[model samples]
Target: MKKGMTWLAAMAVCVTLAAPAQAADPIKIGVQGAQSGDLASYGVPSLNAVKIVVDEANAKGGLLGRTIEVVAQDDQCKPEMATNAATKLISDKVDAVVGPICSGPTKASLPMFQEAALIAVSPTATTPGLTEDGKNPLFFRTVANDNAQASLTSDFMLNNLKVKKVAYLHDNGDYGKGFADKNREIMEKGGTETVLFEAVTPDAVDFSAVVRKLRRAKPDIIVFGGYQPVASKLLQQMRRDNLKTPLIGPDGVKDETFLKMTGKDSEGTYASYPKDTSTLPEYKKAREAHIKAFGSEPGFGYYNAYAAAQCLLAAMEKAGSTDTAKIKDVLRENQVDTPLGKLSFNAKGDAAGMGLSIYQVKDGKFVELDHSIVLE
Candidate 1:
């Protein structure tokens, strides 16, 4: 009887000792993006970027000695699909989430993330509505919103290009319409005339009809608001039609796909993006690691995604707990040094003092022209 009692006590002590270890499970970070839709070029790279950061964090002993696990889902660029993905992540009880690259999907899925009290951070969603509503305090973005890019692009057109009269062509998506409206507002305010504004479906390859209308306007320039694939098609059609006006667009049209799709027609096309690649020693080191891990060059969205992940990890470290509320507060207050320079969120969960860079496609690559912060 005495021997049995001693054995039982030893077993109980072992169980108690193992309890803490069992409770220290890996922390899961959910990533939502359009992995299989028209935006896959952006989404896949963005997802890989998140993976690189999480892997590096784990290799360096992770956050508070807990390994980071990425749980990714394809939102497919649809609102319903995005909401479903958000719900799935919330059901899995993720510590935080890192995307739905497109603006429409992000806006549609915001409510689900807010209800779950999850810290939803986006690397590429740039619609002004996300931040303008003053709702979803949990929402955060690393990229400059469309409003900034629009104002900058508008200013460039009016002052430098001396393009007083311009025509606007947008894909009519959330991203397209948002940029068009904001650019029009700012261009008019800046003393430039917008002669025509036209919207077209994103998947429509035959933009000759739209091109005809734009040519009729006979504006000095045409500004397109859409991604590379559609933008490439439109530009190709414009070239085929012998339109010579300079074509300007937002970051959505800035990618290798754009160049490939538009062929040699991409030359001289302008895009507004975040600042030129940060070559600071720290960012250089991180970039090296990223290239080594992914075995490829990171895109514009990659750096932003990496920054978002680092910010989340930093917040988790500061809080010393995975509690969403505490992490949110910590993130709002802390300034993390990332590849994109210092990152700090404001009351609206926007990266404080962020700006856009203007670039032109020269020799089949995005060449930085000017890096400027939009003053609100």
Candidate 2:
């Protein structure tokens, strides 16, 4: 009996010693956004949110027993810089990329990611051209396209505000131009003529010339398609020139930074946002945690970034692999619950059922209106 027990113990020891230990490779997620530039307001908050999501996941044993690491790059809101950042990430062997925030940069870097078979998700790149024909298989966005906001803005202007003519101004970049063009099309179709269309250089210190032109045209409303920095400067200049025609803007201007820039000037100014969920229980909890880490509330773009990070990690967990193809398949087959509510991507990599709602700057805050327009 003693000899038989010894033999069994020896066999168990040999089997245990022969088994190979599993390797714990860190999963790397590349985060590209404007860390320094006018658009940093959009990028910085989103990145902070991404960090929160990653940290939370890491705290819970991570996904698939691997620690997640985020390698962030500053695109500086430039196209060439974005391409270079993507190349660096590819060389670094990142599992996925989370951004390229602005539309131009996103467009520029998307082909590289597609060629490399690396999945990318954009939180703020809202141009309709990105997924128009359903060509991009490896790219996705949490935010709705500009068409969604354009529809809401056009409908609100024509049906509610009763604005017959609008003066359209854009900053000549992909994001600004896309919004301006889509808004023009939607407004024209809704019986609102675009009286004056002009392009302004982004980051121009003085908009006196543009203001003078707008004052002469005197449309019922003025719509500016650009980031908050330019939008605020132009709005301030318009106020100085006394061209207050109830200025409105796209999601780019629906930010606290814009409110601080314009102060009382931002009052009565309307902007369309993805949606406001400040009152939701999930959002409240998330925002509290965010404030504890970042000292502020989440912005319009933050929710999308946070959602993208969570969705990416969740996909990896579901697939039990960091392979891009598996993650992409999981993304298509699953719905992710986030602070922004339930999210699912469509065939074109656009967030299905994602929509927009209008917000008016009132008392130094963006207050959601009772209306919303959804474009699936």
Candidate 3:
């Protein structure tokens, strides 16, 4: 019996000896956004910024002594695909998430992330209702809500442009149309006459019908609330039909894709983007890192994404655990220095103290205009 017991003990020892040492599990972060498709320009730069932030963090020995791992899923800016991406991230055991860039996908993915009790910070996704509705507690964003953006845009139109009549247009998607609606409300409140308020089909190859309407209306300015693909087509059609009304757009139209698509036609168009911070040392470092990694300048949402990742990491470090509730508390209470200046989240999940600036396409590049965010 003693010999048998000794043999059994030896077998246990052998099994234990054969077992590999378990390393500390990595703290995985999921980057969910459009890595391909039409909006790749927006999402890819966001992912690049996150990657640079993560790489730097890892180089310094990842958070809480556990290495951080990044997992990205392309949602193509589609709602259905966003849920799938969120599911994949959850299955991959990610502790937190960074995006689902557009407002629609962000809205669609929120319930799933909520079910998993995962927290996500969006760099874009500016629709007001996303956070204002207060349905999702885990939601946060680095960009101001569409309300702020619309207010700024309206203020620009009412004060700077001083136009008597305005034409408001949107692609009819939640994000675009929501922005358009807000702008419409604010402009009307400011006593500006709405010459034409219309929704354009997102898939329409020709926008001449609407351009014709603008021509007939002869509005002082055209405000287009939509993204690049539709914006490019609409602008081209408008210009082709000789409609020279100044068309102002949202940040969705600020990408290189828009400029490349429209070329000379893109010139003189204005877009409201989050204020440029390239002058800041931190922003410059991030830009250098991005260029090093991707060999080009960062595009739309790049600064916002960098800020989002920095704030997320800062919140995680301050929270001292992966507990989302704790992290959320940290996010609300703490401020992090980002390229966009020191940023913290308001109760509505909008980035506090962030400013928007108007940029005009000049010489094939977006040039910052003198006027900027002066919201009341």
Candidate 4:
């Protein structure tokens, strides 16, 4: 009996020693975005969406019996800042990351993330090359690449808008420039003339000179490739210069910030964004929680961010471990029903079925023009 008691005490000591490993503090989730700067509206919403998701997840007793914590790092949508964000997250020992929103930033920092064996799910990075040839196996996204978006835009401009000559303007960054180039290529292939292709300095507040050049081009439509700040300023300057040509844009300018900036001038402006799933229960729940917390509708990429965070958390649960490799496998194989609907990733890390849809500024807000523009 004495020997048995001594052995039992030793066993109890072993159990106590092992408890801490099993009950390690909350799992850390890193969220990277343009938390502050000219693109604050674009980035803050992604953080807010993740916060809402994190809160809901914690409320439900967390995932895999471990509470989740968000470690947000702001990249400010700059390439240099993005590398810094990745370094900090690596130091933080986060299990996964949600974004580095801009394509330039995402491209600059992805190698660091890959080296760290950290899994990432971008809510808005849409460059085509990011996922090609399975280069970044650790990287995944809830957004479609710009290649598909470009195809859709070409079809829309050719078939729906029926424009012949178009002007192309870009911010010269990876996302903006790549999207603009793709659009020009597609439109040219369809026999539409690209009258002018120009890159504007993204930070320049005065675009009157560029607007002047655009006016001389006399394009039927202007395709602006960049975020709302530049787009808004360009549109404002174009209108002020009496160039009433309709300016169409991509997801970067689809936010309410663009609408607020352009005001009356925003009318008839078109942009392509992820298809709306506002009617779905998953989407409704997220929106309700966002409004309850933030007192307004969620901003651009909010739903996509929600979907991203949910995908990460769900993959962790499905894999039954925080091991990124296993979670990555689950992410590929399992379908997660997020605010974006049933979501799964391909080998290239792009989300399946999350195609771009057209939205137009109607009555001071962006309203869905068409969601069924499928491109081969």
Candidate 5:
């Protein structure tokens, strides 16, 4: 009888040891990004920023005493890839999802997220259609949309700089096309004439043809609705061909990589962006922490991604449960204090009371040129 009791006691100890492991299951969060495509610069850094936040959160005993696990997937800036990634994350039952950084991928994959009842917060997807659709209550974005940026950019070009005629160029993609359309609409509404509007394939290496067209039109300013890769090449080729009009662009062209790609040619280019880090104390502290951790300043997508993750975690904590419905409600109603300051979502899940800031590339660096111009 004593020998039997000893065996049972040993089994009890084994069960107790296994219980801790089972109780410590990591709360998984899905993170999707274009880790291997044209937009990798934006995706990779944003993923790294998410990691930084996850690490910091875990170090603080994690959420609800459970460690956070970020399940990262590469969407490669493709819609199909984004859909597959979203499906896989949904099947895996992640508590929340962070991105599909580019707008094309974000728009393509949003339906899957909605069907799966997952809370998705995009760090960089700024296309207006994502939130304006009125179909997906779960879709949220930390970045300002193209409509807001385009309005402010139009005002800056028309009212401030007093450019009466503007030429608009965009890469033929959802992001580029959407911003170009919005900018044209706003500029025309403000009584400014858009002399030339054109869309070029993002991979086009020869922009002399477009430059010739622009030169023929002879607008005072050229507004580019695209990211750095195309913008840099276009600007460089324009310079080589001696097209000397001032360039204006949206947030996609505001990164340091744009200057690096275009070199001296990037000088005098103007860009519209959300609030700069220099103006926020919380952002300054976050920037210092990020530099210390990653050995460089956080890029545009980095801080935004971190803020998105912080917002998700804050909502999770407020809901006190991993239930998606409760979490979504918490996200919509609660104000999250993140590295970017107090962020609150509207009924549409878009950031509320946010504005865009204008920057100018002077000496190959983006310098904040004006104060925040409120849109709504």
Candidate 6:
């Protein structure tokens, strides 16, 4: 009897030790984005938002009762580097990925994620090609596509601003060029003449040649499709060259970095974004939590990243497993409540009911237009 009791006590201790070990096996999440370079203005805030969401989820006993760990990889906003980051994440066995914030990087890295059966939810990659051709079933984004923003802006320019002749400027990257092309087509179809279409190497400090071309074209407005760094520089150079053509940019220029880079020159410029929700009562908790974790209010791409994390966690919980296939199916069939709103994906993995609002720079800040447009 004494021997049997001692054996039972040993077994109890073993079970106690093993229970914690089982619970400690973390569900790995990969965060792929530009941690450095000009795009960091957007990517860093997004990563901060992701951390806040994941930390909050972990506090309530992480997804599926397992701890969650983030495997962060910096792609520097480059395509090949993004592919390498995706490869590393696959090797590390991350259960899901949160980024590749730019469209080009996302495109380059998407095939690898699809092949590995990993769920990739991007907060910002808005190119239509991501979902147009049935490219990857496992990929999703919290934001609307560029087509919606471009169309809305084109309509606003024609109807509201009454612009006749416009010029197009774009960075040569996939994201910028795609956005510019879509906007050009829409504006032309809407009865606005495209006076000039030009591409500039991204990160170029001088726009003398482009400004000269724009002067020749004599456009009433210039639409730029590119990220903050290039957009800011182009605007500064435009002012230097005394070109008074009003410039409108896409979502890529909607960061605070643009204002900081262009100073007073950024005033009166325009950009489009999903309607702001940071002040709404529904997102009050999320906003406070983000500030608590990051020691500041969230910036560019914050809400979208939080929404992406919510989508991933909610899908994982609903599926009752970490299997990517199951989670993907759950994401398709179910709606997840996020700080942005209740979110659902369409057949193409695009967010349904997402839309855009045109914002103009007012006294060095972005303010909404009198109206907003929804993307169906």
TM-score of each: 0.95, 0.92, 0.93, 0.94, 0.94, 0.94
* Model 1: residues with Cα > 4 Å off, grouped in runs: 2-7, 10-14, 374-376
lDDT of 6: 0.86
Error of 6 at 302 (Å): 0.7
Runs in model 2 with CA error above 4 Å?
1-22
lDDT of 4 at 259: 84
Write one digit per residue (lDDT tens) for candidate 3, span 1-376: 9999999999999878766323457888899999999889999999988899999999999998788888999999988788889899999989899997899899899999999999999999988888877788789888867778787778888989898899999988878998889988988898989999999998888787898899888999888888999989998988888887888878898899898899999888988888877788888989899889889888889989999999988888998988899998999989888999888987867788777888899899999987777322
Winner of 2 and 4 under TM-score = 4
What local distance difference test score does each model get? 0.84, 0.85, 0.87, 0.88, 0.84, 0.86
TM-score, structure 3 vs. true: 0.93
| Candidate 6 per-residue C-alpha lDDT over 252-343 given as tens digits, one digit per residue, 9 for 90 to 100 | 79888888889988889988888876666546877888778878877788888888888898899999998988998998888876777777
Better of 2 and 5 by lDDT: 2
Better of 1 and 5 by TM-score: 1
lDDT of 4: 0.88
Q: Which is better, 1 or 6, measured by lDDT?
A: 6
- Number of backbone-clashing residue pairs for each candidate, in the order shown: 0, 0, 0, 0, 0, 0
* TM-score for candidate 5: 0.94
Assess the local accuracy of residue 295 in candidate 3 as a C-alpha lDDT between 0 and 100.
Answer: 92
**Model 6 segments more than 4 A misplaced:** 1-24
Using TM-score as the measure, the top candidate is 1
* Worst lDDT 10-window in candidate 6: 276-285
Model 1, position 30, has a per-residue lDDT of: 95
Clashing pairs in 6: none
